[model samples]
Target chain A: MTFRSTLAALALAAGFAAPALALDAGTYKVGFVTDNTGPLAFAGTSFTRGAELAAEQISGGGYMAVGAKIELVQKEGAGDAARSIQSYNQLIADRNVIATACCILSPIAGAIKPIALNNKVPLVIYGATAPGLPSLPFVYSVTGLPGPAEVAMSKHIAEVAKPKTVAYFVLSDNEAFQGRFKASQAAMEAAGAKTLGVVSVLSADTDFTAAATQAIALKPDLMMVYTTQSPAAGIIAAVRARGWAGLMSANDAISPLAVFKKIGPPLAGVPFPVNFSADASETPKAKGFIEAYTAKFGAAPDLYSAQGYTAIWLIAQGLKSLPGKPSREALATALNKITELEHDVYGGLPMTNGQAGTRYTLFLNWTPDGKIAAWKP
Target chain B: MDLFLAQLLNGCALGALYGLFGIGFGLVFATMGILNAAQGAYASWAAIIAMYAIELAGLPFPLAALAGIAAGGAVAVLVDQLGFEPLRRFGPGNHQAAMLGALITSIAFWIMLDSAAGLMTGQQSLAFPPGSYPATVFQIGPLLLPAMQAVSLLALAVVGGGMHWLNTRTRFGAAMRAVGWDPVAAALGGVNSRVIVVATAGLAGGISGLAGILAGISTANISAGLGQGLMLKGFAAVVVGGYDDIRGTAIAGLLLGVLEVFCAQYLSSSWRDAFAYALLLGFLMLRPRGLFGGGGFTRA
Candidate 1:
């Protein structure tokens, strides 16, 4: 068989790992559109694992109706705007798919939102944190941007640095990162800091030295970086290499341990807010998630996986709430009615019109050893 | 002035990487007469292997990197034998059709490599151990170069110089030129054109492997599709520098890298990508044969 066929076979087998053996419960078919191939593959892969874990939990824990099995139909989004729509359409058109959780990139979610609305297939956004993604009638967001947490992070940094000026390094094309910059900036300015300047690069940009030099040239007392993990690692190294080390913070995109391994001990004590942390808290569900995720994936769950797990968990819970056999419209109504829920990933999160308000406990600091712990300061 | 100097040094450092990355693409195009679309995948494979060696086997920096580079060459050879050779032999009747067939095969191989990398990496980015390489700062008057950048610059010099020597002064270079020009005639003359093509592919893969590892260490752009941006930037350099001219490609890569930095710093960082694209378009219109022009494809 060709490599393509082999991969397709593997995907088909993996997606259908849970056999529908539920005696009396109607099989609830849900769809997951993933960007599992390109630069954003990290999120897609992790999110899928999270969804798998949750799907297993729903079956074993009887989170759904008795003998009610949840079938996850996954389509490859390929992490592009055009491809996401095609994938979403495939999910919506066939197989009685009640709802679809899609995308780790916000831009893609935005692109597919209109299509989902037109099809009236409830779209549960797994991880697109772009700011101001309007939660429409049929659309819901599980992963909100780190804006609120960035504000909290700014407050935390203010307690330590109290910088009077701030400079920004951002992924200019990424609305999510830009939202983070804006939030961090607002909080800093509220603390009496002035904007120094902003230097930007595209999301795919690798060379951060030039942008870093320009940002540091402004000599801001504090530097706030808001980009994905790869750029976050590069910019951190670049800025530190140039000795702009008054105080630095970044969003949770850099929370991955692999990224910390590259940036090295330079990441020590850098504060960032995220939506999920494997740092076991007083919350039992979170502790269970950490253990389960680590046991299955061999690594602690990060933000993307948490978003994926929560997306599924939310969908399952919504499906469970309905009295009769689950339908698409009922599932949509069930999802919207759930304004809040206690989740393992984020403390209190469900879908809303704008930001799905979540627990800010993921405000994190990097341990020198490239692992993360809940920030004390 | 100090900041300008710093940016200049940084630009040079980045350009060195870009040049090293692009030169491999130029080498494959020059020797094989086809774009190795899988060039990025080979880079990624090498990087993942290197990272695995470091993280799992506890190999030190240089040894682990060498292992990855060598693996890259081996993988390239395998692809050449399995993917490209079949296309050349049984694909199509015409030259253009065969070339296109080979290109499509490379792309298929690229996807295949990406899937393999995705599986190996668990679709997560891996990095060298934090202290695997020291981040020492080397200062020159007003300029500062970090250890990573310094090492990459050094690599570019050796690579660019070595490729130049190999292309102009070696028997292997002659074989490669002969093979690239007319494989049938070269075979008639006992040049062992197949061996030349395979060796050239191996060398190209090794260079891209170096580029991948360097990128991982310096920028941490290490992932399944990590080489996509490199492929784009490298292809741009190749197009602007003349596809067959390695030295010209390297120089063009550096120039593009510096121009990107200057535009981002002095002008608008938001539209910096557009500026580089505009430069690429201008080069295409003004100097279609590239800066060095051409002495045909074989004169590399």
Candidate 2:
């Protein structure tokens, strides 16, 4: 044989020698739909990475129960709702993916939820935190929703700080943040704290001198801010610049330590609650997860990263439970039945209420030095 | 009341940046008789370039600003040569068509630049360290003002003064006005209208770059959408101030900024944007000619 023909034949032989990881004849494919680009691309990248890693590790170690290889298909949602739905439809129709994972944006998740239900495909949402998802037989959230974070934060504030009065500053432009803030405010009021007043700020407003001045004049014991990093940082800087010494707290939207650092030392003692953290050693799983994530991603994983990693692990766990070659119905039932599953990466979270929601969250507060540690409620 | 005044001042500071941006838009409109929609993209490029220099290259802040200004000027000149000049030879009625082309080209350029930036550096807001400039608050009986706002206002003054000097005191300025008034006449009179046009675009771009750098420093963060929203608001300011009236454009920019702040303070923050557009719509309907109306130029 000619040298070229020999090389080609050798390549073919090598390809054939590799394991075929396709699903069984009767099994459908599993599609991982996510945003690989746009505003929330970072979250999507981590989610895809986590899922891909889990699939590879599990398959390599012979973790599948049915001795059938699973096929993983990935699609980019581009962080647009219409495009997400279109991508979902394409994945469902073409790939026949039995299960799917979705994006971080609540609106996009909400839009895709209906499509997943209609197609009867088990949908796993990893990043979205918007509350009040309608009951769908196939849709399940393995990560903590934004509601619990707010609830936990309010309870912590009322129990620990015991502030006489609280002022709420919410970003009125963003509907999701606004809704979460309002709900948290109601919870705080129910806990017997007097609500000073709610102030609305535009997301586009960078300079918060006026808002800070007004907020200080109210003389509330604590200021609860609900906004994203950019605007929230601006508000914190403005308030800190004016030397308003009242206890400052923010929701998950403003939880990143980088934000506090950017706003400078005035935000030293500011408290905020987050769902996950690299230094939350209250749980034994924190150190190991942090080490493994840092080793893999070259940095300590943030809350988003942890949630993303846990999400794929949850999916893999559910996929492992199927008796025979897993089908769409089998995978869905397996996922729905997951309870108190140990996410080796994230300590242990119970997936309660299969299609409705999940109750799993951890409260973390930022210290003066920017380290986020679990606060014992 | 003190809070209201403080917010208004804060708004004015932001408005000054917008005004500088509007001046750049007005300069292009006055000289070329075509609205350059790419003004914002150029500004964003300037900001991104500055950010890249400061964050990635680890250059000092002033050096980064200089690099940004140079890049902005280069981009403006490039757009004029490649995107605008070929279409400039079209008839005066093609002015609208030329603008549409520039708008589409600018939008495309924005997307390309934004994507390229994102791919090169992972997508996240590039936040600068605060206290890069002093955060000293100047208090006047509860109406507190940031020292940075003072710097912003000062920058606006410099831009205004520089533009005035360029337009009135310099021979090149006279030549520019001559070309703007009648390009055919100026070319016939040996004015080199093409050179004037390119120079105008470059100068306007440099000013826009300065605005972007200032904005990046002031806000402490730079992102892909930096220029998109600013472009619309700047255009509105140009329209309100009168496309040909440079001074009016600057004033209108500050006015819009203060108006947005007041609206954010009293009305819901969500309505602040609506209020800005509403003001623009009201102004457009009431005075179609703009605040300073008179068309003195047409592109040849």
Candidate 3:
């Protein structure tokens, strides 16, 4: 036989043998779609692993229906909406997963939320904080809305820096960020802060020297940077290079430890809210999570990890309330009813409306020693 | 006035770096009559390789930079040999086919390089190692210029001066020029055209690698796609300066940088790129021969 025929024969053999290795009929599948590979892999993988760790513990320790263990089915979206949608469909159609969780990107989550509602499956959003998300019933957000954070951030700037004038440097590459930018501008103006100007930069922009110079010349009390990681570093570096000593604050986009290491000393004193802090072992549950996460993963959990871990627990809470095999509607209702609870990682969350969590946004500042610490508002 | 002056000097410094980057694009085009799109990929790779050398291999900053430059040159030579050389030898005899083939092949190679880089760096835009460059600003009268700005300009001057000396004073430059003039004729004249082509590519890649490092220092972060925009700006400089004229290319790059900052300063920052490209379009329309009027594709 020719090479093509030989390869086809081998593939046919594997296809024939596939059903013999199929999963058990009683296996309950839970799906997760996020950036598991590519630039966003660090966050995506952390989220997936967080959910996986919880599922493993629950299934192994018999927290679910007797004789039925949960299998975590993860799809790598890589921050693309189409890919995320594809993964969501695969989870429903191929794996018959009861629930889907952990979409970090606003666009991807926004796209898949409607699908989850239509399919009668519950979606737990971890990272995306878009204001429009909570209105959908089947979708439960484990994160704060960007509107609250923007309001909080503006008020914090007004309270601390007390700048009469503030300039905004926002990344306008997506609708989600644009919403946050508009909300911030409105909040800053409402707080009696005069706008020097609003400057927009592409997330992929490599040079922010010009933008930095322009903003510096304005000499605002604070320069609000709502930019993604790489551009945030560049803008911050350029601003500091030009000797602009004014306070710089951002949304959660700037909270990553990678940003701290990249911008180095310039990052010190810059405050942003984080969903989780490794140093935050204030609650016993948080302490348990830190210890367990370190033991399991060989490193401390990040914000994504905490969000991911909490997302799975939220689903498990819904699952545990059911006396029998939980239907999609029942599970979503249970998730919707989750209010005023403590999680293994994220402590004291309140679920309401279609949204499932209170704003647990903790402000953190980069220290001079290249570490991040909790900052009081 | 001080603000304007500061921005002006900043523009000049930025322009110098742009010109430094533009040289790689210009040099390859001047020699090969093809725009090597993989030039940006080489530049990105150089930054990444340099970062790895420092962050992972524990090499000192300066040595890491040299390693980066060497890597750029080596990768460029490899691309030429593996991708372009065979096309030059056996691609369609038509010029259009040859040009299109090279362009498509270079773009494909760039995609492959990007994928490979993504895999290696986990798509992370890494910061330069701490203390990579001292953040000191020098004030002359009212102008506040970062020390990195001066270094950028001085480096560009050295690069331009070295290139000028190489072209005007060296035997290799003479053979290289001959090949650019007429490769077949140069081959008949006992000069190995292949060596000249590969050498020019290596030299261009080395310069681009330097640009990448400087960009990392200036921006304080480096990503795989960082070079794409810079590559476009550099190509615009090459086109605006009269393609084969190195001095003209440098001058045009400086002009573009200054113009971009002025636009961003006076007008909206969003209009900056629009105004720069408008200038490019104006040049292509009004002064098709470019500012210095050196032969580009036609002569080649």
- Give candidate 3's error at residue A371 in angstroms: 2.7
Give lDDT per model, in order: 0.79, 0.72, 0.78
For residues A1-377, could you state the per-residue lDDT of candidate 1 as single tens digits? 99999999998886665333222376777899887776777667888889989888888777776777778898988788888888888889884898889977777888888888777778888787776654555788777656777888887787767788888888888766776788778888888889989888777777787888888788888888878777887888778876666678888877866677667877877788776777634467877898899999898887778878888888887777776565677778777787776455666665566347675546677887767777654
* Candidate closest to the true structure, highest TM-score: 1
| Candidates ranked, most accurate by lDDT first | 1, 3, 2
B1-300 per-residue lDDT for model 1 (tens digits): 988887887778777877888888888887788887999888888888898898889998899999999988899899999999877677777777777788888999998998888888877666676677767877789676788888988898899899989987998888787787788888898898777888988999999899888877777666787777678778778877787778887887887788778888888777766877887788777776777748464221
Candidate 3 residue B142 Cα shift, in angstroms, is 1.9
Q: Could you give the CAPRI-style class of model 1?
A: acceptable
Look at candidate 1 and give me any clashing residue pairs: none
Name the lDDT of candidate 1: 0.79
Q: Quick one: how many clashes does candidate 3 have? A: 1
**Each candidate's interface RMSD:** 1.9, 2.8, 2.4
Candidate 2 wrongly placed segments (more than 4 Å): A1-30, A66-72, A203-210, A257-267, A281-286, A355-362, A374-377, B56-58, B89-93, B296-300
Error of 2 at A141 (Å): 1.3
Q: Worst lDDT window (10 residues) for model 2 chain B?
A: B291-300
